[model samples]
Target: MENRVEFYRMSKTSNPKILNRITEQILKAGFSGNIKVYDLGLDDEASMSLIVEGTYENEDCCVAVGYGMNRQNLAIRKKWFRHAP
Candidate 1:
């Protein structure tokens, strides 16, 4: 996920809420549309909603790092992902 790494290098925003250790702020938001996980690099093109400030965090405040596509769209690709960080 080279693009995901690049986002961390270039982003400047911050979150006030203490999120989980594993977190990913949206440099670009995603929406309900036909797309792929890698399309997250497209700041203005992805099908997700506009996120002024977003922190994708999990339970216990651990920041979740990953990509998201619409629920209905996942079946189109049937891709399985694993995260180890």
Candidate 2:
């Protein structure tokens, strides 16, 4: 998962089209369905986890997609998450 993020980031060297293609491939590996992209953030140093209020399969499939994005963000951009101005 994390590796995908790195690849996604590195893809900037190639082109946006290639990055989008790679993203599509990652999503297709899982069952096509609703996916919510969320951010894990902190408030005053308090930790909070993203909650998905719905049913999910235990196949590690959907989670894998999320794991890739989240893991990568945490690994490479832990301190650069978005903040409202």
User: How well does each candidate superpose onto the true structure, as a TM-score?
Assistant: 0.16, 0.26
Model 2: ten consecutive residues of lowest lDDT? 73-82
Note the Cα lDDT for every prediction shown. Answer: 0.24, 0.31
* Per-residue lDDT of model 2, residues 1-85, tens digit only: 2223324223112456644553454344432344333333321222222222111332322232222332322111221222345
Best by TM-score: 2
- For model 1, how does the per-residue alpha-carbon lDDT over 1-85 read when each residue is reduced to its tens digit? 1223212321222232311111233323222122122222333222222211222222111122232332212112222233445
lDDT score at residue 60, model 1, on the 0-100 scale: 16
lDDT of 2 at 52: 22
Per-candidate clashes, comma-separated: 12, 1
Off by over 4 Å in 2: 1-14, 31-85
lDDT leader: 2
Cα RMSD of all models vs. native, in order, equals 13.0, 12.3
What is the alpha-carbon lDDT of model 2 when measured against the actual structure? 0.31
